[model samples]
Target: MKKRTAAAAMFTVAILATAAYAAHPGADYIKENGYKGPETCEECHPGKAKAFLDTVHWKHASKVTNVDGLDPKKEYGMQNRIYVMCNGNDIVNNLKEIPKNPETGKTKFSGCNTCHPGDHLNDVGSKGAEAEKAIDCLVCHSTAYDFRKRKPMKDDKGRVVMGQDRSKEAALAIGKPTAKNCMVCHEAAGGGVIVKRGFSFTKETDAHAAKGMVCVDCHKAKDHKIPTGTDPNNWANDGVRLSCADVSCHGASPHKDADLNRHTAKVACQTCHIPRTGGAFAKDFTVWAQNPDKFYEPTTLKLEANESSPVYAWYNGTVANTPHFIGPKGSKKDGKSKIYPFKIFQGKAFYNKKTGELLSMDFAPPMANGNTRAGVESAARTLGMKNPEQVAKEAVPGWQTIYFASSHLVTKTRALSCANCHAPNGVLNFKELGYSDKEVVKLTSPELFFNKVAAKMKEDW
Candidate 1:
């Protein structure tokens, strides 16, 4: 009788543990039978699959509702967007021209596709049921995600396309996304590790990361739609701004001192928190001039370190998304504007002399044959511009600037002191920020300004 009771207790404990494991997102639903495609997930979570299809994660585009100058009714994202990187061309845009691997006889997916979750080579070919089947659900959900398993696979129509890990372990390892899930793509963006976003989840850099808080703690996704702040180059989470001052976070008045809290109204949290970006290898400047040796490579590539100074600017949330011009929408005079930190990146691209628009070239093709001119013409043709060769001929190298908000790599302990911006030899250019000489002098003189606020405040400083 004693032995039977002990056996029963052990069985109950094992059953309870199994139930607890099933509580994770999609864990219970996804059977541990085998590694099927998104169709396997759709069998149980049809609505989830359908909802995810419309999200920016899958489409890589969203309605242009946030950008200041863009038509709100139209859609914008990686498919149609341009940036200072890669000669202004979005990744996988020119799939028709991308050459097939001689050995495989299969057109290998572009390097950018590694981070992307879709099975299709490019967005153009992915459509309808095919698109649904292409969604790699494991990439976001599975803790055991094996990115190395991503390789060429046959689609429904027997066409070979890029596919992600379909391992049984990945299928069974489904759960809510952790920081590792988000960082897998975010960390390795722009061709290399820790190159693009400069978001290395470490205690030394970020307070939130120090506490083992995941990105979703702040990003706060609702039905797979993650929220991010104002960024002209990124259209993913437009209009959905996440900030440290959110009521759930530090709130309106985070500081103990009333005088310091007043600055919160005019200064963004990131202004002091995120001192710099372009960590280690982020390309600060690139010139897309033709290279004789490597036709695909940029003429000049200048990388910046983690301590690189950010470009200070005034921001009222809205950013211009005009193809030819992109920047923040506010000046110092704007009542709603707050002082913000930005990473100002510059690149040289082929400018159309007649239309004043920059031409996006398909440099991927030229990599195979060492033909820069052909790459330019191929890109011009893809744009459907008249006289592709003529457009390439008339194109001239010109400078383009892109401003990205420095909102990550936050360090409360290492936050800038008041003297860093208020001293005589301060980092900020007061005149450039629209302050008059008199106002600048008064602002710069921290001692004189703090004296009138409170005697204790001056002593504390």
Candidate 2:
């Protein structure tokens, strides 16, 4: 009798789980047919597949039309993008030979495609029918996509790399992308949770997420091209600027206070909305070097962790990007400049002293045997360095910095108190922000507040 009762409980639990899954919109459609692959999706979404192929997400390359100091016509993306994070791209011929995770003890493929929506490795230029096959439709559209079902598989070159799940259930489970679909890759970018964007949108951080709004609601895509507003770290820009004052969302004058509304002319919404960031998961600095175990692990230093206030800067929607540095191109005196909040990322990268160029360190090569010299050589060759050996030989580690906009983790109703910026020990350093002593005094004075309010009231009257 006890054995029968146990069996009944197990059956009941299975039924409930199945019922929940069956509630998905596409689940009922499975009764008509089964999923074959991306071909199955193409049967219905023919235009969508073609449209997505043209996007930055599919090509991983873009004609950077909006960034300053870089050739706008020259296409740039992950193919040649380098960052101190991950010690640059970790591409290796044999993906299976890459080192296992110290924490998980599982050998996993950690390439750029690990977060990409496509199944093909580095097939950035794939188009038409070829791109449709290369694209992993279920990865983004299906609620039933299972990571467990995606085991390591062999690529066309017989190299063992990560695989995808296009099972019948995954195809049948196709639905509009939710936060879960987007966060699967975004949350894990730059190696771990909230690592890239110190405080990404979450239920605890963003008012939008708290209200169950997904990323796509704000970052709406047209032909899969999403707007990324002036991130110095990013290599591509589609020129579709995003603003808080959009007609569909917040209007020009959102605040009840006239003073606050006037401030919008010289201050971005994010400066006040994103009061603080990091939230204990942020890493402000990372130093990359071969570990004692011969595996290259980034030594992270959390200089500003656990809900730290942002570094305020003036921005004019332009950036200075080069091989060694990337930063905003706005000054306090710039008439077009507006105050913005930013999370500063600083890191160390290997630089070739001879060529005066930064060397990319392929983490996979060093991870296998801890030979950082070889990793540097591999990266130098990939970057078309004529003398890879000489470049690697003369490489010296140095620090670089990039500032990312703090545009998310927004509080709808919460903002920095006047004291947070106006007090003697305020968050912003007026001198560092290019303010003269006299200007700082006037800016921080209590009389400034009353004067502004009085002026606003007088104008209203």
Residue 298 deviation, candidate 2, in Å? 2.3
TM-score of each: 0.84, 0.83
Candidate 2, superposed: residue stretches over 4 Å from native: 1-29, 90-96, 99-108, 155-157, 279-295, 303-306, 450-461
Clash pairs, model 2 backbone? 280-306
Per TM-score, the best of the predicted structures is 1
For 331-429, candidate 2 gives per-residue lDDT tens digits of 887798888888777667677787656567766655555567777887778768788898887878776676777778888667775656775687778
Q: How would you encode candidate 1's per-residue C-alpha lDDT over 282-311 as one tens digit per residue?
A: 232223333343234454343443557888
Which ten residues in a row are the worst by lDDT in model 2?
A: 279-288
What ranges in model 1 sit over 4 Å off?
1-32, 88-97, 100-114, 121-127, 152-160, 279-296, 299-305, 321-325, 448-461
Count of backbone clashes for each model? 0, 1
Residue 157 lDDT (model 1): 75
**Model-by-model lDDT, in order?**
0.68, 0.68
How many steric clashes does model 2 contain?
Answer: 1
